[model samples]
Target: MKSKTKRLFLLLLSVIFVFNFNSIKGTAGKSVTKTVRVGYYQNEVFQEGASDKAVKSGYAYEYYRKLSEYTGWNYEYIYGDFVTVYNMLLNGDVDLVAGLAYTESRSHLISYPDKPQGTEQYSIVKHQGDDTITTNPTTLKGKSIGVLDSAIKVALENFLKEKNIAANVVTFSDYDALLEAFDKREVDTLAGESDGIYDRSHAETLYPFGETDYFICTSKDRPDLLKELNEAQSQLFLEYPDYISVLRNKYYPESLASRAFTSSEKEWLTSHESVAVGYLNNYLPYSDTTKDGKVTGLIKELVPYLFKQLGYETVAIEYVGFDTYDELVKAMDDEEIELAFPVGGGLFFSEEDGMFISKPVISTLTDLIYSTNYYDNSKQIFAVNESNKLQYYYIANHFPDATIEYYPSIDACLKAVLKGEATYTTLNGLRTASMLKKPDYEKLSFRQLGYADDMCFGVKIGNEGLLKLIDRGLSRAGTEYVNNLGSVYSDDMYKYTFKDVLRENFIGAFIVFLIILAILILLLLYSVRINRKRIREKEDAKREIEAVNQEKFVFLNKMNNYMREPINNIVSLIRISENMNDLTNIKNNLAKMGSFSKELTTILNNILNISSFESGQVKIDDSLSLYNFFGKRVLIVEDTLPNQTITSDIMKKAGMEVQIANDGLDAYEKVKAAPSGYFDAVLINVDDRNIQGYLFIKKIRDMENDIRSEVPVIAITADESESGKEKIIKSGMNGFITKPYDVKAILDKLSGIIL
Candidate 1:
């Protein structure tokens, strides 16, 4: 009886355990069972020009929402630095990263989806606080600049590679906030695009002088997933109706149904005579695709039609996606993206390459996709490209309550949404519609916001041949593209309906579009404008180097002329007259001589810069920022007092207040006791018995348990060498302040932390 009773209990327990396990799965329904790990640059902003103070948004937000919708997967968003994101991906701590620009350099490090809904443009935003002239990179020589990401850092460094300029770059993960700080004059210049576009896209204050493009990128670890995305995207673009609508919504929403054209519109189509065009990817929306899944979009529809009208046969088109722009650029440095359309000129060159501008294409606007259950939450979450700054600011303005997460690329961002990773995501409109038509989109819906810029095709840096044609073609056929879009959609949705408008005067619009396409032949009429040879231009391609060498040559000539004077003076004083020299007087002469030589060297450098600037061929260092520091108080601690009082008075005159220090211990004690260590900084002289300046900084670092201890330090000394500087820096000083320094250097160092 006891054995039978025990067997019954055991069976009951087994049944209970299974029931609980199955119960959990039943609740999930179609949702993914596993937890998805997502990583973002927590500092990245969702809206353009907005900061962390704002909400989550941009292309990243829409893409992820779509992902969650499709997969029913739940995700944990991990926010941190680049290393943190990348390391997590490697460790399986993160299953995905989205909204990153796809490039060859990044592909080597991670996997990527084959589809790219669209490309991105970067801008250099300047603040109204500082002197706007200083906003020009060319004017900034020795200054501080703020930047985000290693890629941008490298681009800045490469830009100023040969220039003799000094830039102290401050990095941040969220570029939008950084720009806001810049507008507030916090960082000298924000080096990313968010602020840049806000300034440029508007008319009131911000000015964008330069721009670059970013892409949707990801790791290449999962081929199967990438293949799915690749196929799905291709199909998304091929849908004719969506492609036409995207153009309408992006560039001509007011004329969404209007087929009307001005006289200039008639001349736009005849422009693309004999062209070369390239496609960034083979994904949907940007290219044409079929039911089986292929690449097709507004670009694809327009490329062939435009090419045929350009009076060209068999236009050579290349399929070089996000990853290949660089390699192809190396092949076409003065060469083009080998693609033709009315797009921005700078697209052909990566942001690092810095090129020109093109006409215009339909704006590629991204939308925020959300799960059905998401809006019910009091606070929405936004996803965006971690590297995109402008998207952050715009998002913040609209969704005030959202928290943001950064995804590496657009595909992964939407994937996060389809998998239910977040409450919101920003996505391309055409893509959202096409994806919705799919079986997966049943769980997703697109929240129609405003529109993005007119998306365009790309060409080489200096190629006006194709650009002129595109502008003319676009000018003429643009109305038709708009009209056609109207015809493609239902009357209710299409509003103006291209068929009705075009039918009224369709032949006239087409004829005008064709006329402009024919007139593009004049861009090549080069007889009036001869290629002028510039002696300066030929040598100025590498400006700094030639200038420095020229200075060296001038120095050698001076040395040759003055070589005998010092020796003769010495000999004459020693051999003949008592009046010729007093030992003390001789020492004074030598000191004065050394001082003059140093001044001369400094003056020469200043002269070289003036020369570079005058040439009009000199490129500015992208990394530099012009700053001003005056009337600031900095702590000075040394084992000795100022005997000369010369350095102190000079520092005071240069707009700085100096705190005196009689000993190392006194300086340390004084700095520590100050309210919150209220001093701007500590400048320690390294001439003590045991407590030298270098060691003093190290000790302070060790004492720092809170934010106060993280204060900046500078070792004021005469030792400036590779190893010596390294040792000094490692000792925990923010940097070095050379001894016998001029008032300028002192003021410059203090400017960074204060201003």
Candidate 2:
């Protein structure tokens, strides 16, 4: 009886122990779940609606939701107007407030992240054809400008004061009211964000100024959260450098669809019974596959329609759905699908893998999307797509300090960022833009990073024929299709119709038309005046030519005297040689005759050089180290005793080490045999009988040693005409010295070229 009782007691204790263990495990699971409190305002870019009970919608909201999934944190959103939300954050009722622009006043109350969620620039928007209205602050003086009663309005007032412009600023309670005032002509200009006011065909966006960084605000008590948030935000930006641009395009959809298919592509499409197209299973705006297996999205609706228009009456589009972009790429690579729509640039596809890509079906910007609290953080964890080399390289180059965490998909990376597990993620601008417009992702905010590469379709390497066909179809779609598609996806689909254009700009257009007509008449009168002036100038130029010709003739006569004396001397010497009986006497006479002949040749060569120089046939290779060369050594080549003495003296006086060569042949031999760079500059007299100056220069230029060939050469000549200068330059000589050398001028030219 005693043993039975002990067994029952022991069993009871064991059962109690098991129950406590199970209870503790359940409690611990609940404790692990964290609740994050978010303060939201009803702003279109931040929070879309005023619903307090429903899921918060906006860029910030959606971003945090994804973050919650990443971090295993639950978000409790508190909704209010801008002021209410801001106060809640300061009061610690909310952990953080979304989409707050950083200001000195705000900074004193709450701590901000290191990097902004995005940037906002103020734009002066005016109706199309309002040419009189300009972006200049001075021009805006005395004009009525409409602005919303937000931080931007304060910025505008400050700007006006700083610029000293006296403008009548009209304040509106909301962006819609501001735009309404602009539309009704109540205000001449509307100042707002570009994404809010930019229109391709209707409103002209101008004068972007007062760029303010938007951030998430957190109480001083939650510095840790702010620090974490900042790290994550910075990492996101590093990965997706153009996330902000994507946001702008998403809200605006400014890119037009203009690709048209070629005839061959259309023919190929018609021949094929069906085409297999891969699309994302859940990528919104770009592509989406439903539970019923129906594919629909911007790419889905437009791609099929584009095919139908390309002569394929019943071209069947067999849709293949993939959970991630990677899967889509794999499907294309495996030839399971001929093409994949709404894919990234060639960076995502490898050429080695044999992929043929089409032109972008939709083009948009890329952006950095992050929480506002972590605006300036750098040492943060970044979530990036593992396969995206573009993002990988960009991040590696720009954000070296940030830790990188790879995800299979962009969405997954973004989720990591949202959860605070990773600091930030980058994405295509249009994709971010589309996400912002949706209620699910309304809380996320982005800053324009840069223009993203256009999104295109990808095909397997072997599908070149089909790829061309798809590209051809894209080419046929044209700009209208793109504009229409943008309108469908954009926040405002209203385009400027002919009637609207006329109604808005009739007076402006009429004034412009009258001004243009007047300008044309003025231009015509100016042309007539210019033509009359040109005729008179031409007549005057002809008279000037006659005077110049007379002067040249006189100059030539003076030069002829130099030739005549040399020729006469040579003839006298030859006649003397004929009378000589002894061999020594005969040789002496021949030598004298040769000297005279050489003198004549030198005069003739000088004249020829002058003519060539004047004709603009000479090109000077001015690239020479004159100071280093001339300071060391200079070679003076001249057969004439008087000229040689003058040349050597001038070179010595200029601080150049002189090496005298009696004639051109001697100079050439010295230059050819000397070590490279031995001579700094060579002074040649082309009149030498053995080798002409031109031949010497040409030989030096063609030498095996580059240093010797490149040495500066200056011609010493009696010809003072422009033609003489031309000839020296044409012969590859750097410059010319007249019969009477000017020491200062020669030194100056040398100094100028060398130094």
Candidate 3:
């Protein structure tokens, strides 16, 4: 009896202990806060800054803050340069990193979530004044470019290589330095994120190369953390479908919401009760109406959301099932339908047809489809829809001998080709892809035959208001939405010819073989002409160096001669003045000295001006109008006594109302105190030490009054190089004049620019 009581007591103790342990474990799980460590670098719209204050306010920081709210996680921020932060994540020093773009190399080191956090486009940026650089990659040969030492550098290098362009690529440590180098003319072009460049008013995007998906990456070992982050992100997106757009607009407002509703447009929307929309019955992926009369597809989903956002609460969508697109147009003309979607091309509609078309919702490649075994040398029948005038014109012009057969629909055309009723059919690549999925169309193949067709929406004539509304809605519907819709239906249907296959797969090998053969031929040629070529090259280089040295020597000798005359005259005048006791004689000698000094200044100025013009540093502004601005009033800021007199005399002779300031400080005060338009232009000597030319100009540019701030300022400098001009222009100067002012040249420049 004692042993049984002892065993029962022990069993009860064990059961109670197990129950308490489980309860404690559950409580611990609930109380513990998971720490999420994030690594990031400074970017304009992404990380923003490395400082704790700025990092906390950045897009990535805000994103993580929202994520923490969803996941109940605490964040620890780690900041460094991009490469260093990337390394930290790789080494597991950080649990996750924000604003990382996925690459094949990066994929091996870290894991990205299934859905990207956002997208950014990469662009080639150039000075707004630059017009010589073409958008074509082939034109980039031998051009200099600035890029960050990150993924952008790799992308730029790859692009250059692919185009066979041997460009000079300069890499910077960060985006700020890269832009600085470009602004300073160290590099003619820059490659980076579009938002950074587009934000600058002085810079413009030449072309966009590609887009990258931004992700919050995790260390390879932290897959569970990555999964949790993704879940939190998905929840946020689900709860707020416009979260990404809102973030983008907050950071890059200039790139989004470019259009605003006018008062009239607002009034129209307020007065309207509902909008009538129409769609076809068989336009897959874009729009489709079911047999039961239910409408669906991308247009149906996008149009309603857009209308709602535009402040319309109700919409009436109708499906118009016609035997042919022509019949559908006839129905619209008769006012049976207000608007129709998935219209093929603009060529089908005209003012005469009483229809207005919106901009393209999507672009599709046109392809020619035929059976694999079918071939005929004689005149062949081309199957097409009569409503598709663009395709009809293309076929009739390209195949003059072929006969055309009109079909009611794309489906009928494809069937006609398959059943040998027509020799071939031309259809959109996207539609062909959707049709080829069926087993019956397995034998049909396609080849791209024409330019891309733009699919849009058509409205009845005189319905301009409805057209405008549709356009506004389409503009608000971002590129990602349209691209997603396009990707669902479009497929690669192009059948490569034998030549294309060879070029794509083995061109490198073929080029190598050709190079080897050429080398052998060159060797044979060299054996016969090597001696002559070597002697000629050496002699030519020797002659070239000699010519350059001789030219410099002649220029220096001429300059010395010019200076000697002025010095001799001044010395003679001084000696004469020393002997003269009469006041008139003394005044005469002083006048001669002044004349010599002026002549000497003119000689030096001419030399510098010639050099500047020859080096292409001084760009003449042909748009200046002397009668308008500069001819009326001008301010001259010069610290040097000699420069002040020379510039004032030149401007005065040019018929300008010249106002002189002894220094930058004096100029700033005078300009600030003056009324609007008191001075049409300003010419400041950048070499002045007091108040500093750049600082003074910046202050003037930041003035509260628009007219006073916008007064064109020209830089006067002795440094006649491109860098000098660039520095002046970047300091907010409208133009620059190299030292040694010519009255006629100065007047001409002012006249061209002042208007």
**Candidate number that wins on TM-score, 1 or 2:** 2
Tens digit per residue, CA lDDT, model 3, 1-755: 99999999999999999999999988986756798787867776666767677624656768878888888888787878777888899999998887777899989889999878888887777675676876677767778989888777878887787778898999877666776788788898888887655345456567777678888899998988988888998889999999988887787665411233444555656666665566655556666666687666676677776676555647554455543466667778787877776664444445545778888777767788887666453647898876545456557656768889988767688778888888888866567676766656777888886677677778887777777777877766766787787666343223222221121223244345436534643543353254345446687576654553454345545656866787677667667766878876666566566566656655555545433432335543444333444348898987654455556645654567888887777888998899988888888888745638898888888887467888888887778888888888888888887756554467666766775
Candidate whose lDDT is highest: 3
The C-alpha TM-scores of every prediction are 0.27, 0.32, 0.34
Cα lDDT tens digits for candidate 2, 270-346? 57888888887555556676668787667667767766655565877788787766677778777798878766545
**Residue-wise C-alpha lDDT for candidate 1, range 1-755, written one tens digit per residue:** 99999999999999999999999979866644445556765433232212244456544545555555544546566766655676666565666765455556766766666565444334344443345434355654555666766466655666556554566667765555555666566755555544223332111222233333333344355555455555545655564436424532443232211222222433433443334444433233444234454334455456556555534446555533332333434434544455532223234222344433445555555676877755545657777655333345456655667788878655566666767676777755545564454444557767777756344554555554555555444654564583354234312121111111112243254345335423421221221122122334566554654554454345334533443454345335334433544655554444444434334333333333332333333432333225433655767665422211334444454456788766566667777777774766777766344445655566667774655577777776667778888877777678777754544466567666566
User: What TM value does model 3 have?
Assistant: 0.34
Order the numbered candidates by lDDT, best leading: 3, 2, 1
| Pairs that collide, model 3 | 605-740, 623-752, 624-751, 624-752, 624-753, 625-755
- What CA root-mean-square deviation does each model show from the true structure? 35.5, 36.7, 34.7
- Global CA lDDT computed for model 3: 0.70
For all candidates, the clash counts are 108, 57, 6
Candidate with maximal TM-score:
3
